[model samples]
Target chain A: MPLNISQPKRKNAISLTPLIDVVFILLLFFMLTSSFVPWRIVDTPLSVATDAPAAPEERVNVILTLKQNNGQVWVNDEVLSLSDSSVFQTLVSDNGDAVFIIQAEDGVTLQSLMSLADRLKLNGAETVSIANAFAMPEAK
Target chain B: MKIAAKYAARKANDDDNMVPLINVVFLMLVFFMVAGQIRKADPIPVIPPQSINDTRAATDPNIEIVVGADNILYVDDVLFTVEDVQAYLEQAFSSAVNPDAFWVQIKADGDIPLDSLRPIFNQVRLAGLTKVSLATQLEREAK
Candidate 1:
């Protein structure tokens, strides 16, 4: 019997199929699990009942009332359009250290109140507090 | 012989074609992994109000309260009433490592009425957690 030795052939050490499979899985995971919304925070310091009351003499207080029916805002007694930034800017600047008490009446959307609070804080109001007008009384 | 040669060529070409696809897929994977934030979805969909304030919200807070436009409340994805939230907050506060530093993040729908949202704040107050952040989106335009 004559020895017939076949020439050695090159063999693929690793398959690309598995590697591609993993990459595809990762791509799918990221595509399905990620969120791209740009979220920001507006510091709304809650007036906890536990805090000691500040001195009334030193800090000025400004009342920002949001009316439900008209979608208007009132800085104390004077009503101003929420979009009018100039007047509110002046109000914020005049009372630099004032604590703005935002009172949103019934039916006022949370968005309007948040926008006004954001404006006040942006204009350099030191302390902005929301008055809990709709706070449900103690329900045990 | 010609047919075998053509089949071999086709096989090589098929592998080469996959390289570009793999490269593009890798790029997309990296882009999504880096650019996107992985967060649990909110219990209810909420389109928050927009603001020019550039403060970024904490990625994860100790307490997250979600208020829907329909006056529904969700605490940690569980439906909660005003009274129930107060109890939940108090319990959360006690177990917190630093109770005073634990702030609550409120994600409320822009269309939610203040009447529906205020009681939650009052509940948070009763819990003794003073610090609160209202989640808002960055205003897109000059307005």
Candidate 2:
């Protein structure tokens, strides 16, 4: 007796195009989500007299300036009205180890400045120095 | 004939191996998504105190608090009560390896009241973390 044998037939080839597309899509998703972190900036006012060339070592100091216009207080150029919530508490909470230098315009009112100093001292700031903007002569 | 048939069989089997690549991609996707979920400091709008001295280098990975025009308390952008802040700091200080090395920076509007500022310091003391700093700007020299 004779036996007959048959071989299996192959037809389809695996396609790589779809796999590459999925990999790229995942890469793009991660890149976009990671960049969403927000950045913030705050501005304060500086006294004209205290505005002078600073030595390199003194440049890193954080300065807080105050000015008053028509009984309204401006802190770091941002107007602070009593209606605003506890903004002072927020400031104390965020800055842990920074040095604060307060520079106020002459005749602006010491009551506000002194009050700020007292608060800063209470908030654990080691030094809250006041800069006399009027003590120095006006620069040309 | 045999060699040609073998090559064709090998090519057909390669398609099934693609399952591993798909598994790897999914794993990486899950890892990154979890990492992104961790809470980070929120950008609080603050008028950073300026200084005439340019001696400070910008520090990284520092916690930020924003004092809005309307004196509200915020930590990492979340509105927090004074007591809440105190509780939070207590936990933070307790976990720190060295409370002395851990610092808290405060950026306050120059006009904020002294009365409102006292409780925060009391909280800092309660936390036992002594190092603290205030952010300020340098007084610009006259032109």
Candidate 3:
């Protein structure tokens, strides 16, 4: 018995393999290049000297002196540990409308200062400002 | 004829098997396209400080000031000196369609010393831009 083999002729058939390949590559690129980390913002209204209204006598000034290596936070003359949240809580409650001036000492990072400011804001302290030791001369 | 019919059926079954895979890949493509924010990479990548403030930066400010870990400043991807930052910002402010609506965002490295950033802040203030935002990441809780 002899078998005659004939190839099947298919009309206008397109392979889905290439399309799938391209889609997979695009998915991989998005997965790797995209950042999942959420971004937040801290709104700061830069106070001009002349326009800044004079501080009321009743409003307390809480100076947060930050040092490097997670050093103690000095709120005014009293020293408090960075981890002690209750102290900061009470401080904010006592002076609800206090102006918190975050004074960063030498070697202190912007991270530490912002973290402290965040904590203070969380504790209900209003008006957090950075104390500029090297205050640049006003634009002449 | 029977063998050809069997081969055609097999090919149809193989194509059917890929339907689910194509569906999944298409879904993933759509997910990334919608969920991910495609932002232009900053000239100087800054690891923003973490904060509890979850307020999303609503508007994409016209100006983005990046402060690198080395205290270098880049205003809108252009390298700028401490003195030049104010000038650039002022010019941008003046030329803006809505000066009041025009704002600045400071994306400073988390580890950068605070004193180094003071100058940048001063420049923003001197530019007469009352609205400024400091870009930050969500503070991760202790694991």
lDDT order, best first, reads: 3, 1, 2
TM-scores for the candidates: 0.81, 0.36, 0.80
* lDDT digits (tens) for residues B1-143 of candidate 3: 89989998899889889999999999999899889877778897778888777889778888999999999888889898999988898899889998768989888888987778778888888778778888888877731
**Candidate scoring better on DockQ of 2 and 3:** 3
If the candidates were sorted by their DockQ against the true structure, best first, what order would they fall in?
Answer: 1, 3, 2
Candidate 3 residue pairs that clash: none
Please write out the lDDT profile of model 1 over residues A1-140, one tens digit for every residue: 97898646446437789999999999999998898878888777765454577556566777778887365787768888767788778988888888788877778887787677777776677787754444554569
**What is the C-alpha local distance difference test score of candidate 2?**
0.52
Q: What ranges in model 2 sit over 4 Å off?
A: A1-140, B1-43, B53-62
lDDT of 2 by residue, A52-96 (tens): 776566323456665652334455567655233356555555666
Error (Å) of candidate 1 at residue A59 is: 2.7
Model 2 residue B114 CA deviation (Å) reads: 3.2
Question: In TM-score terms, which candidate is top?
Answer: 1
TM-score for the first chain in candidate 1 comes to 0.68
lDDT of 2 at A34: 57
Better structure of 1 and 3 per TM-score: 1
Total clashes, candidate 3? 0
> Residue-wise lDDT of candidate 1 within B1-143, one digit each (tens)?
89987897798788889899989999999999999989898998889987776788555678999988788889999998878998999999899997657888999888878777777887888777778888888887645
